[model samples]
Structure formats: structure tokens, C-alpha cells
Target chain A: MTAVQIIDDLVARPGEGKALLDAYMADYAPGARARGMVLDRVLVSPPLWMDDQPNTLTIVWNVEGAAGWWGMRLAAGADPSATAFWETAGARLVSRARRFAAAPEDVETLCNG
Target chain B: MAKFTALITLQPGADRDAFARNIGDATLAQPTLPGVFDGGDLILHRQVANEAVPSDAAIAHIDSAVYEPIGGGAHEPGLRNGVYRCLLLAVKPGTPEATVRQFESETLAMPHYIGTIRNWRLSRVTKASGARVWTHVWEQEYADIGGLLGPYMTNPYHWARVDRWFDPECPEWIVDTRLCHSFCAFERSVLNP
Candidate 1:
């Protein structure tokens, strides 16, 4: 049971930061939930945070662990809703920079219902 | 007004019954965001489904969306009664952005029940998952179904411009419409009015 933190730092069209969240909530979130991934939190950097980009939305998803994350991705391959989620998310993301890190032992579980 | 939309899905190694309980607690505990329809929350497999939506997917995710009345649309000080007509689009692959944009703009401008409320939510499919095909969703609510069947449906602007775009050759896009009766439960007015 490998626990890894999946963070996606995404950039969307100007003022389309909301679209990124909407796509996740409406399209991506459920699909990930199906595979045991909770896109539980979000952080948006100030427009001036980046020199070139204006709108950057950072979405955080805590999988049960690395095994769980990979398992979900595998399950999503044949799932129609999962497929649709990617299609929907792809159009909204201008760029997505992702990283995986180890989670702190003293983390809180907000929602994994 | 009772207006909440749910999407349900099933997945591997997921508990159907226990997950329900988690969603119940999660939904109750989830904080409300600052928005028009922010009272409702989501129920995920074992937690709150992200920060929004109470629906169930055919695959593994269940979420929801609760619509609130617009300015003065609330019959009283709170929510109101209205007929909800929601359209979830399943667009064909490679549909031109211009075509989609045009369709959205045209449909949005169509005639509708005056004083009635409408939410033309237009979006694109950007991610992949168990439940696919749904690209965008458009919401409309009126005092009666006639609003959709009458002006919204019959308006020449809708038929001539918007309808034409939903061509028979490319019919997979926006293939279904769900009509629900809004009501009130647990003290909050909902969408299907």
C-alpha cells in the first residue's frame, strides 16, 4: 500500500479557472471517485503568481496510496464515465503540470466517503 | 422547491452500502461555499465527492447539483417552484469548436418564458473516466413545462439556428433531456419546482 500525493497544477484560459473546477466536479471527480480517488481540495495562485500565465489552478487528489491510484487509472481505461471525464478535462486545461510526493503522516482526511 | 440532480456509478472494489453512509456523513459535514445554490453537498464513496455535487454515476461516482432561483425568481424570500429541464450533451468526436460555440450562443439567445429562469451551462468534455460522452450541460427552469415546449422549443431562433446544429448526422451530441418536478424537503427549496 504505497501512499503518494498526486498534485496537478493546471493552467486554463484567462478567467476559465472556474471551468477547471467545474470540469472536475461535473466530469472528473466522480470518475476518480469510482476508482477510489478523492480530488478533495484545490488551491488557486494569484494571477501575478506566474510571470507569463495569469490563471493557475492547483487541484489536489489524495489516493488511498500509490497502489490505489494506479488501480484507479487501470479501472478507468475501460470505463465510459472515466473516458468522458478526460475528454471534458482536456478541453479545459491549457497546460497541466503534475507531480507525486509522499504524504505527511499527520495529514487530515476531510472527505473520502 | 425540491431541485437536486444526482449522478450514480459503480466501480470495482467499492462498497455500495457503506459508501452511502460515508456520503451521508460527508454530505452533512461538508462546508457550504459562497454561491447561489450552495446549501447542497456531495456524497462520495467514502467521503465528500470533492467539494461539490451530489450525484451517482453509472460507473463509480455519485454526485449532485442543486439549483436556486435567480434574482426575484424566488417566489418568497427563499427558493421557489419551477420546472427543471436539464440537457446533458454527448458530443460527437471532432465537433468543431466554432460549431459548438455557435450552437451555445444561438441556443442561449432563443426565446423563453419571460420572467421564468434559465441556466444555459455550456461546457466541454475535458477528462476521461467511467462515465463518458457527457460534454456539456444546459439547465432551464420555468413555472410550467410549457416554457420548454412553447417559447423555448418553438421559438424560431431556437429551431432555425440551434436546432439545425444538432444535425441528424451528428446526433450523439446532447441526446437526452431530463425533466423533473422541483420541490422542498428538509427546509430548502430545490430546482424541480
Candidate 2:
């Protein structure tokens, strides 16, 4: 199976970064796991918290392949809990986005398969 | 079906009906307009089965289109006085064909997640005459203004997922930000019209 990576890049509102991260952990992460994604990593850019400026939370997740990706989407779409988390996330976030990507070695298999 | 849609900004004190006649039997709407909609005064929709939709000559700032439904033009004849909304957008020039298809698929997926859309149509613009050459028209009906502006807008499937294509901040964005988001109250199903 080809492995796929999904990234959620979120920039929190000034002074609210840590709280946003806490919310994602409490509110979003469990639902994400239920949707067939495996939490891969959570990275904080600049590796420090500051009250005056925004902090970026980069969340990475993994699923098997296209099927796994679509499965996650279908499940997430049907889940109101997932919707609620994102709706509330806006208040804490300055900007956010989710991107799909693959590793260099898996690119060919992903494209062909 | 052949369809024609127009987003018209009326000249000061222009009579709505007289100006609407230029577009030919359109279901005209004047719902609460939004900022992105560029202060449009009317949302005009007209459709005919297997016939050419005529042109318009309204002396107002208008963004109009002749299109054929590409997806989801289900009929709901009994629905009345519902809010009808239309979004006219162009995929940026030079976006990959595959990405454009993905955008279309994601857009069509909205009905699956949001139940508030009572009737909907996604169309490909065959002839565009407007402030910009719009590529697609997405039309929908909601039971009330609350459904159009509330759950429809607040739903995660809308803001988090499908919106990625429209949000400039997202790398997945392909559609230009200058979109035509106009809606108005309708007496009957415009999709049926």
C-alpha cells in the first residue's frame, strides 16, 4: 500500500497558539484517528511560545493510500463532531490549511497506482 | 436544459421589473446581498428545456452567463419563497486540468455533507458576458435565509474542505478570489425553471 501524508498547517491568533494546540488535541485529534488517519507528528515552528506574535502548528498525519484518504474524507464529512471542532477553531486561528503530499520514494507508486 | 443567469447592480432608482424584462422571464431575486457580491441588486435565473436562452440588454453593471448544468440540477417544484444562491467563479488560468476536475468534484460534494441545500445545480458556462469571463456557475436553493447564511456557511465541509479551493491562503486554491456570490428570495424552484 502506498503511504500518503496529510498536513494541517495552522497559524494561531496572537497569544492563542498554545490554546489552539490544546483544542486540536482535545477536540480534533480523536476524530481524525477515528477517520482512519494516523497521527504522525506535531511540530511548532521556532520551537517556542510567544504572547505577542503568531505561532504555527504543523500537524502531519498518515493514511495508507487513495482509498484510505477518501475513507477519511467520507467519514469526516459525515461526522458532526469534526465539523464542530473546525467551526470553533476559527476563533482561535489566524489562518489554516490542509494539504496532501507523499514522500519522494512513494511518489511514483502513488501516481501510477 | 439551457440556462441564463445574471448578477445585476441596478442604476440608481431603476425599476426592478422593467430592468428584469430585458433578460426574458427570469426568476428575479433581491435577497440580502453580501460584500463579495459587489452590491448586486438582483439575482436573475432563467432556464428552458432544449432551447436557447435569449440575451439581455439591461443598462446596468451585469455579470451574466449562458450555461448547461454539469451536475446536480434536481427538481423540487413544491419549494417556494426559498433563498436562491449562485456562485460564479473562474479557475485561475494555467491550473492543471486534473486539479480543476478535483475542484469540481469537491464542489459537487457539498450537497452530500450539507443538507440545507434544497435544490442545487453546478453548471459549465457556455457563453459568458460579464465583468469577467466566469467559468462555472454553482446554484442552490435554501429553505430560508438562516439556512443560506447559517449552517450552510458554518458547516465544516464548507469552510474547511470545499473552501480550500476558493481561499487564496490555501495552496490547494485554484479558483480566483473575485467570485460572484449572489442570492435572492425565489417563489418557486429555479432549478426546475
Candidate 3:
């Protein structure tokens, strides 16, 4: 099965979400090109019914491998400017990056049928 | 055969119109991608807001390239050959950090929200003008439409429990209504074979 990583967050601002997303896209652009990880789709939407939290932004990227993802993270953190950008933004980044060893078919099936 | 779906939420002050246009352009520009079969945006109705519900501005995109090759054979008529659903939501302000944290935890705990999902991450952004917003993404595969609503659309008791878990202040006033603007489109491959 394909290995996947999921990055989730609770955003604090509107424009800031766009800015961070742009930075993330840029950070992965080089690696995506180099690794041949196809750009599936970038879906941008607003928060609907999010508990009591106000400004919330959600972004999801579908990629092919873990190496490219780790490489991208390393690149993002290595840059002092990027680190500063995240620090000053007052944004909390919560990420869940995991790799699936088996294909979807080989793993446990919940309700696929 | 099961289909894949993605739900994306936009940050505050993001231009919905421009965002839709960009996605449209991207899909038109690249068509050979196997992950995306057919997709689009969802347009919401304003009247629902007057009903005291939290209306969402959203877009729905469908991808039909799953299972078999595009144009390979006839798919189930009226079933969108291999379409996948994508929903976009417009978030509001005044969302507390605690509330956000709670929401994340609750979503993760959902039965259908586990394993199949990939890249379920969130981030906060600050603009040059000092504005801030929070965003996250949920991608998963479903056997049917019920899978999407399985975790969210259920008994009121469950929802009440989730609300209490997320919001301590004014928990009773927290409603679950959302409005969305949606659309549908196909993915195109830029590089010709």
C-alpha cells in the first residue's frame, strides 16, 4: 500500500494561513519536482463548525513518499528565516506524519466494502 | 470499489473567488495525475445563514481516475465514472486555542477517521498585515457516502459530548451548522505522453 503523512493544525489567522501554505508549497516544490511526487491538488477552504475556535484553516497534501516529506521538513527548519516566520506568526503547527508499510489492500479494512 | 475524498478548509480573509480560479486552472493544466479523477468546488446558499445556522462557503471537486484508466471503459452511468468529493469551508474568527485543540482530538477519535486518512495536519498563518488564521486537512477513502458522515452525523448525545470536550465557555451555544460553496472539475495532465 502507499505510505501517507497527514499534517493537521488549528490556525489563528486568515491571511496568515495563506502565507504559511504558500511557504509550505514553496518548501516542497523543489523536492516534489526532484522526487517525481505528483502534485495531486491543493484544496483551500474555510472552517465550518469548529467548536469555539474562531479562525481555522485546513490544508491537505497527498504525496507519494516519506523521503521527500522529511527532506522538505528538514529544509523548512534549517532556514533561520523560515523558522522566524513560523515563530512570529503566532501559529501553532500540529502535524501527524506516518508511513504505511503495507498497501491499503494489505492492511486492515474498516468499511471499504 | 472504494473512492477517495478530501475535505479542505480555507483560512479567514482568503479570496474564495481567486482560490476557485487557481484550482480550476491547476486542474486544467494537469490532467494525467492518477490520484485525481474528477473534482470541483461547492457553492452555498445564503438563506441558510438566516436560519441561525453557521453557514459555510464551500466548493466540491470530484476525481474519476480511480480503479481503471481514464476513458478505458464505461463506468456506472450517472455515478461519476471515478469521481471523488472535495469540500472547502470558510472559517470564522474568535476560535479559541483550547477549542481548536479539542476539535482536533475529537476528529481523530472518530471511528471512520482513523487509518485510511493521510496528511491530517494543521497550521496557523500570519500575514504581512498582522492577520492570523488556522488551517488543517483531512484525506481518506470511503466505500460510500455514509463513511463521510459516519463520524459527524450521528446522535445529538455524541455531538453534545464532543462540544463539551472542546468548548468549556458557552458550550451550549455552539452549533454544528455549516455553509459551503462547491464546484466540480476534472484533472488534466500538462505533460503530453
Candidate 4:
């Protein structure tokens, strides 16, 4: 089964939304490549309605398994330098939701199709 | 609270590069305001799919947070707006109402935003396989979603220019309001410390 999580109440900063997302992606890409995790599509778009909310950016990519996802996170937080970048960049760490499953196909077609 | 999963969808033929760029721009544009907290992006891909389904599409996850009421205002922005939607995935299943309410208020009033707006849903998958899948859905809508993009996409003089891209006054449904679909399979994993 697929799990869905929505992180709302995002701060209303001026340019932080785009800045944080860019920094995180730049930091995440290299490690994913090294692990044989292919770089996939990253989508950034404005909210359809709410004016006083943070903008949204949705990313899709592929990897082998749970280990692959963990490996990518480890790479992002691996070095002190990278950790510092994440910290100083000031990208607010909002809520995160994770679902356990064997594969993407086991979830549903809304995200995969 | 027990963490739940969320699935996001993009319009057909949506540009990935532009999507990333827009998210980056919106995040960067946030720090200029008050009551802002943190933000980050997550790139999700389809590792598997049912028969006859394409596994190439990507899903982008961009998130941020804000502080509780600014200056002790009466209007709780988070709950009124939809911030509670985020909290639903955070707090333990048995959290108290006060805490939940607090999170909700902060979410509604947060100031950051993107250029365009689209519909999003929160759900839990109850079943899955190559042939069949099931999910419980929750959807949210914001009236000012386009305000972030309005400054850039529309001319200053026009009040209803969005119709140029698609009709605005016809009351036609432009964005999908429901979160039901069986297009892809998703899995979740935790990031290591």
C-alpha cells in the first residue's frame, strides 16, 4: 500500500521556498548518481490557491529499494560540510511522511502513471 | 503523531525543469518575510508500475514550516488555511487537541508561496499489487494559490488574465479536486541521521 503525507503550515518567508529546494536537490543529486540511483524528474510549481502559503515542489526518481533511499539521505547528510550547508542554507525542516512497500508499482497509478 | 504518506500529482506534459526552477525561486523568495521557518525538496520516482503503466514520470516534494501565531493575532492561519493537513502526518495518533490546533493555525497563515497553484491530496494506501491498489483520500484547496504566480504570470492591469491560459469565469474545473487514482506504486523509507 502507498502512504501519503502532506507537510503544511510552511513559513511565509520571502525567497526561502525556492532557495531551500534548490540547495537540497543540488546536494542530493551527486550521491544518488554514485549509488546507481538514476536522476529523475523534479517539478516546482506555485500553489493553485492559497496566497499565504509556501510554494510547492514535487520530485520523482527511481532507486532499488529502501536501502537506496536511505543511502541517498546518508550521502546528503554524510559530510560535515554538507551538513553545514543544509543548516546554514536555512531550509526549514518541516514534517516528513514515509510509507513502506516492496516497490512503486505496489502503491497506485496516481503517482506512477 | 503517526507519520502518514502523501502522494502528489502533476498535470500532463508538465515541464520538469521549469518545475524545479519555479520551486527553487519560490523557496528563495520566502526568507524576505517574517514568521518563516525551514524548507527542502524531495525527488520521488517510480520504481515499479502495473502492467501497461509507464514508470518514467517523476514527483517533486517541496516542504517548509512556519511559527505559531505572529503577534498573538486572533485569526489562526494554519487551521483556517490547511496547515492542519501537514500536522495530520506529524503528531502521534493520540496527540491532544490544543497541540493539533496550534499546528493548524500556524500553517494557514504562513506567508511563503509559489507562482502557480494546483490541487494536492493526503491519503493512505490500504492495498497494493501489480494489478490492483487502494487508498483513502483527503484533498485541500486555497483561494489565493495563484497570488504567488500572479505577479509574474499576469499583467498588472488585468484582473482576470488567467482565462487566457484557460477560462476563469466559466466556472470550469481547471485543477483536479480529488486525489483518487491508480496510476503508480509508491514506497516510503526513512533518511538516516
Candidate 5:
């Protein structure tokens, strides 16, 4: 499936960072997969970022379409497991900024430009 | 599964390496700790890499997250995965060292807490840039939040026995705490635990 979105939850501490990733994987991944979202990779710092000020993480995800993204959010709200997971996971963060990111084609366009 | 974790910073000039080593070895002890929900510990340096060779000064902080990972996240012993309720602790200034040790021993005793609290841990931070707002940490995990806080915080033993050393009103409360939540990503898990 062609990818539709990417998310990044920038965090400070490793333990908390790890928790963020696991909640996505455990509570959300199964439901998300049924609707076409896959957890692509979990990236940590060093080669993962500059200067190690952010050694925590940057999670990348791929969804089949915008519909799938919305589907996941709605499903999370209705699912007690997902809701509970986020409750604990969300509090661990120092800061979180998630935004739609460039797909491979978008990246290609930028590279060509 | 849910988890709650907390931290505490080691004093300067402390034998930090020994302190870290002691906790590591404690988890590996012959008989498992009671009410730990069959979980173990993972030691981290500044929240990045596992300092297999723990340093006396390390990277200014150390975290001992207790978990029981799913998907075979490791069973025999070591950090496990679950829902965690982590807490940050601030020590009040001038509370004699002996009293602090007394409180530490009291908290660790199993009778004071409930069984659903699968895992509990502590971290000692250094004077590094990674230092947190609080110097110490502690946590316990539960299946769900439900009413864990009300009961745990109000346990007669905790308030009557342990509260003497704590003061939320003090400018520098001898023991100040905040609740947080987290799960084990186990990003560094070699076997995917």
C-alpha cells in the first residue's frame, strides 16, 4: 500500500521514550494494522540525531491512506485498552510533536527540486 | 499491565558504581522479590545506552525500570513490559541521612503496598545535563488505574508510619512526589523483549 502519514513523538528520557513506542505498538498497532497502518521503524539517537541532546526517539509509521489514520484515532477512542494505554504513555513525555511527513514520492520530489 | 516508576539521585562523591551494581545484583538474587509481578530490572545511562560497564560517575543519571515484557520480552529475570505509573521524588534539605535510609527500608518492605503493584524501582542521578527536576524516582504497576492512588496514598501504615518523614507543605518537603505514567518500549531489547 502507498504510505499516507508519518508521526514523530520527540521525547527526553529513554525509559519514558520507550514507553511511548510500546504503547503505540501494543495498544494501537494491532487495531491500526486491521485498518492499514504499520509501525515501520523505531529510531533512537547517535546516528539517529545530532549532538545527542535528543537520544530518546523518533517513531516512523506508514498508513494506507488518510481514512486509515482517522480510523485509528476513532478506534482508539472507543477501545478501552488503547485509551488506557495512552493515559499512562502520554504522561511520560517531556514534549511531543507529531506531524504529517513526506512520503517517498514527496521526498523524491524534494530531492529532484 | 500498568507500571509506576520513581527515581532518586545519589549524592555527589557517592560510590555510584557500587550503588548501580548493587541494584543490578539485587534483581538477580536467588529468591525473587515478593509482589514484583514476576518482573526484573533494566539499568540505563542518561536514558540512552545500557552501561554494561557501569561507571562510578556514569552519564549523570541511572534508571531502573521494572517491567514484564509481552511477546517473550524475557521471562526468567530482567526488565519486563507493562503499563507503568512512574513518579518523581524530591528530597527535602537537611533531613539527616539516617532518616532517609529508614524511609527507604520502610518503602521497600512488601507489607506496606498492595500486590497488584507488580514492580517498583529507584534511580540515582548524577550532576549531568540530563539531570531531572527531582533527584530520585519510584514507581509501581497495576492492571488499571481504577482507584490505586486513593488507597495506596491513604494506607494507614504509609501515613501514620511513614508520613512523619514527609511534608508536602514544607518549602523543601522532606519528601515530595509527583505521579507519572509510562510503558516499556524496550527499544534496546536485544531479543525483542
Candidate 6:
């Protein structure tokens, strides 16, 4: 079966790495799960906390396939919880981006079907 | 040179007969826009049906301002007393002019994808005199309410392709979230002279 991956690249303001992650777990993750997205893992770059330097948070998520991908987007795109989380989290973040991807071998099934 | 449309929502138990009398007596400028309508600068439409699809309550009244058509206007003879839908929206401030034009072009492409629309017009608002500063007015005529709530809403082009401009989660999103999605009944073809 084909699968789709969603990655969120977020940079937290200096001294805000931990606080932003905590807030994401508390506010954003629940809504994401309800929208059919499964959290895979989260990674922080530079491997250490810094008071004066920003930290990059990479969040990985998974869905079944193209149908699942679109379903998640349609739900999340209108979800007020998602909007509220980002608006409120804006204070603790420098920048954020969401990316979609799939495994190399499953690309054909994901795109064609 | 300018197109205007107003979305009016009545209070939950407001008196309709009194409001109709006042609106009928209201003065309006002469309409310069090409289209078939009774003499007036603004045409009043009371919604026959309304439902909130994604968000916000359905508007009860629509005040469409007169103007010369700028870009798109269409009509199909013999389609009358049908659904006339209008969308009032604002492009967020600070979005590049080029991006706004792109969004406009994308919107104008809807007829190509959905064949149910009988008449349509897309115009930019020139005046800002309302509670919300709306930037655009997108109007369409349909054979029935099902034409709008069914194929138009379910088309992939609508939800998948063009919706990104309105979807807050999209990076390409430039439109404000507050929008007036309202429709009403019309006797004559509004997009034809």
C-alpha cells in the first residue's frame, strides 16, 4: 500500500524551542490525529538547547495514500483548531513550512491511482 | 467602472415586511452596468435558500451595485427565476498585485470545469464603504440550487485546485478568511443586457 508523509519544519524563536514543542503537543497534535494523520516522530537540529539561537523542529506524519492525503488536507485546511494553534504559536516561532512526500517505490501508485 | 455587492443578514426574528418597505423606498444611483434588470443602481435579492458549507452563517440579503463589466460576464437564455449566487471576498493586504491577478484568473476558470453554471460575472470592488472592505465580487447563475450545492461544490477543480487560494493552511493562501457566500433568486438574466 502507498503512503504519504507530511513534514513540518518549524523554527522557534531563541529560548522558545521547548515551549513551542510543548504547545504543539498540547494544541496541534490532537487536531491532526482527528484529521487522520498519525504522528511519526519529531527531531530537533543541533542536538542541544540554546538560549540565544533558534532551534529547528522537524515533525513527521503519515497517511495511507493520496485519498488519505487529500482527506487530511481538506479537514486540516478548514480546522479552526489548526488555525488557532498556528496563530497562537506564531509568538514562539520564527518560521514554519509543511511539506508532502512519499516513498520512491510507491510514487507510481500514489500518483497514478 | 466599479462593481459593488452588499451581503445583508437579517437578525433572527427581524420583521421582513417593514424591512422590505424601507428598502423599496431607498434611493439608488442609476445602473451603468450592462444587464437586464428593473431600473435601479442597486438590485436587492432576498435569499430563497442558504446553508453554510465550510463556515459562517448564510446571508439573508444581497445588495448588488451596478457597474460596467470589467472581465467576465455570461448568460444562457431561457434560464430565469433561478439561483443567483455571489461571493464577496477580500485579498489580504500586502499580497502582491500579480498574485491577486493570478487568483482572479484561477477563479474565472471555474466555468470551464463545472458545466452547470448558466451565467457568471467576476468584478473588482472600487468602493470601500462597508463594515468589511471586500475586494471582489464573484457572481453566478444556476438552473437550480442543486447545480450549486452539488457539482459545483463537489468538483475536484473547486475543492482541490482553486480552493488553495482560500485555504488558510496553504502557503499560496492570500484571501481573508471572512467571506460572504450568499445566493438568491432572480427573475431576469443579470449578466445579459
Per residue, candidate 5 scores C-alpha lDDT tens digits across A22-107 of: 66677766865664557788776544433325456677777644344445544544556643554466566566555545566654
Q: Which scores greater on DockQ, model 4 or model 5?
A: 4
Give the per-residue lDDT digits (tens) of candidate 1, residues B1-193: 2123444434655554554444553312221122212112222211112334334452344334433322122332333343444444455568787766666665555423223344333333333222334555455455555554445543334432354344331122333222111211112223222
Model 4, A1-113: lDDT tens digits are 22221111223234456665666567744644664456455555564323445555555546543334344434543444533543454444343221222335543322221
The alpha-carbon lDDT assigned to residue B6 of candidate 5 equals 22
lDDT of 4 by residue, B1-193 (tens): 1122222333446654454444431211111111111111222222122112123344333221211212112222232221111211223345365644444343332322211212233333333221113222222222243332233122211111221111111121131122222111111111100
Q: What is the DockQ of each candidate?
A: 0.01, 0.07, 0.02, 0.02, 0.01, 0.15
The alpha-carbon interface RMSD of model 3 comes to 15.4
Fnat for each predicted structure, in order: 0.00, 0.09, 0.00, 0.00, 0.00, 0.12
Q: What lDDT does each candidate get?
A: 0.45, 0.75, 0.32, 0.30, 0.43, 0.67
- In angstroms, the error of model 6 at A98 is 6.4
Which one is best on DockQ? 6
Q: Would you give me the overall lDDT of model 5?
A: 0.43
Poorly placed runs, candidate 5 (over 4 Å): A1-113, B1-82, B110-112, B127-133, B168-173, B176-193
lDDT of prediction 2: 0.75
Model 6: TM-score for chain B: 0.74
The candidate that wins on lDDT is 2
Q: Which regions in candidate 1 have their CA more than 4 angstroms from the true location?
A: A1-113, B1-5, B8-79, B111-120, B125-131, B169-193
Q: Report the C-alpha lDDT of model 2 over A14-94, residue by residue, as the tens digit.
A: 898999999999988999899999999999975888788999999999998766876776686577787678778889888
Give the per-prediction TM-score of chain B: 0.47, 0.85, 0.34, 0.20, 0.44, 0.74
List ranges where model 2 is wrong by over 4 Å.
A1-113, B21-24, B27-36, B49-58, B73-77
Please identify which of the two predictions, 4 or 6, would achieve the higher TM-score against the true structure. 6
How far is A34's C-alpha from truth in model 5 (Å)? 54
- lDDT, model 3, position B139: 26
lDDT of 3 by residue, A27-107 (tens): 644544454344444444453433333444443444433444334433543445543544444453332121212245523
For each candidate, give its TM-score against the true structure.
0.34, 0.61, 0.26, 0.26, 0.31, 0.61
Interface RMSD of each: 20.8, 11.5, 15.4, 21.3, 23.2, 5.3
